[model samples]
Target: MASRRIDVRAVSKDPTGQVLRALYAYASPDAGAPCTIEHDGRSIAAREGEPIALSLLGAGVDTLSRSVKFHRPRGPMCLRGNCEGCLVRVDGEPNRMACAAPARDGREVRSQNSFPSAQLDVLRVTDWFFPKQFDHHHLMVRYGTTINEVMQSFARKMAGLGTLPERPAEAPLPEEIDCDALVVGLGPVGLSVALALAGEGLSVCAVEEEPFAGGLVRDSLQWHSRDGERLCGAEASDRDLAKLRAAGVSVRLSASACATFDDGTIVIQSDRALWVRAKARVFTNGCHESVGAFGDNDLPGVYTARAAARALRYGVRVGESVLVCGDEDPALDALSDALSAVGAKVHRLTEGERLLEATGSSSVSGALVGRDERSAHKIKCDAIVASTSRTPAFELAGQAGVEAAQDLDRQCFASWADELGRTQRSDVFVAGSVAHGGRSPVRESAVARSVRDYVTKGRVR
Candidate 1:
């Protein structure tokens, strides 16, 4: 039977989509020799020398395993290899992250603590039987004599969670890099800053936390040039991506902005920790989307506009119907565009009341959005996409004492900035949405250039 071709354009705005497409192309046996490792009863079609899970997700398998206690379905959450939400058993190993796990093609992936496949897991029966009882495993106490025996006799005992296989340990190594300017974030603004710096022949480094560059651009169809030209459609964006890479700027993909310091030092972690000493730094870290503060808002199928954009760009169709509501323009506009691009029937409310309730018990069936008075209406959808504006990724900036306030207009926290985009800290410069200077191609370039000139000329003195 012919396999269904998921719309790859859905996730085209996300940089990860490119990595996923590259991985799939490299790993498919039909294309060439599989690029993965093969072992006893375990084989992963490896590409890019990483685990199979990232590729699988890029190929559209977000729900790797179900929750242990509630038996609710779960997928990749913290892609940082930290959150155990995506845990699945590979070969003889138990409870490993699919995002961090490499796909070896022939490798056997099994559901832990559940019968049959992770998708159709029978252990979900526990949710029906023990409804409110959130117990995945029980606790236990060892037997003893005398006073210990007396306590043991009175107290009941249970066992803890099962163990995982031992892994080989090794000492870590240190690495370093030096650049004239380091732009953290590979979004449109980040790439723009890097390109601008490279145009001036400055040694610049652009770092993106995701496995691929381009940041959110891969999922978005709208691309703007400095002259205010709307570069929509997938092909133009891909061409732009190639141009960014062709520039002399060093693009660090799959790297994170781990931390920042007072002396213009930046720490990024990928396979290992990299200490970067740059003459100056620009943070285009962007904003966070808001989730509805209602019952079961964190359930599967519930996602932010950015996440929806990712899902579509990466061939991960949310569902047949989509519900989109938000406070701002870009997010709502983006979500609407992505959903329409992927053939999803969309019902949108730009500035409606708050989300009252998410209808379905499992997997979404519908949602309730308060209208006015008793006229609250129900928006039926398989997926809910929302944006409550965005907050500056200010953890690092907050450490530098960049002042922030709740903006009455956007109804979100924004940073206080001067005319030249320099923060209160004389050494630090802020750019992109991180500075809350409003989002636009022109504004971003102006802010980035101000900082670039400040760094290149030392004019702040």
Candidate 2:
């Protein structure tokens, strides 16, 4: 796994070239400011706003952390912060989400839950000892009550998080503010809701975890319209964001909504603490890309479709040869094309073909695909982009009293919402994949009408 940065000039003439250029413009030589971060005692160049996970991966340093019990290697599964696979210690802080944190010059980053190093953990013997399952209760029973104390002490030493800081860091004071409506996500649906509400003379506050506001729009190569016009996803998102700002919608980037209360209080965390009190809350947090359950799926070079797109957009070299396999969808097709445009040899598995396992040691070297349970073949490649259907991001909605049930047909959890995006709670609503469990036509007018009625009428229908 040698460190390598993809050459941006190779894809300069491609359609998605503008996206890669815009994403990595800050890291360019002409771009001012030297941003270099130290990881595992090695200095790596980084962009001002680029995620630390991408920077580390670009430097050929995968295996951000090790599994707690078996010490198995883990890398970034979802470029978004939904998955804990990319947890790392940053600047003496343990268990920090690398994918969510921006790389800062002079910052020290290290992997957690591994002795020696994440790539070569000595505690990996635990995997061999407990090959099938890891139940401490069962282990204790087998050893007898006499060894209880010894077992407890050994378990505490073996299975634990990173070491605590010698001195406690100062916590920032909380800032409180009030608004007419609070939008929890800044995706297309969330942006639309904010714009529509703000246009109606209501004060709005929208929060997004990502540094940018477009959500998936920023990752797509080109969006085709019914009128036969090809538009870049990032450009469209920027246009919409501008409209929201013009309408007086307060936007918070690189901020996460930590929690929501029944009393209409929303807690957000970024550089500081922000407590927002709003009359109505709208959740358009979208969905998380689902990873398939296969052997070595957590390998360093195995990426989800969303993660692969993010890596390419950031001009990170995922691999020279890649295997794209997932549920049959246009998004998968677009990602394959995008990877090929970026000079990577792209190979796609047939629809309905199941990925049995990712074959690799330190990094993915190939993928095993099969049409049936017994028949399978190996495809040689340096990387594997694997994904299944997306699961609705229902955590915020669930906190606000929305109900979610498993949708067996879709193979994901689906939230219950009316056509107008209204949930069980009168003050709460949902939109986009968070409401539908999958991609659907954006019901802009319907969501807008519902929000207006809720704000004006102040009652749940």
TM-score of each: 0.69, 0.91
Clashes of each: 30, 0
lDDT of 1 by residue, 73-171 (tens): 665543434345567766657666665565564566655544455556676776788766643323222333465555445332212222454554343
Give residue 375's lDDT in candidate 1 (0 to 100).
69
Q: How accurate is candidate 1 locally (lDDT)?
A: 0.59
Cα error, residue 115 of model 2, in Å, equals 0.9
Best by lDDT: 2
Residue 218 lDDT in candidate 1 = 54
Can you list the residue pairs that collide in candidate 2?
none
User: Residue 309: error of model 1 in Å?
Assistant: 2.6
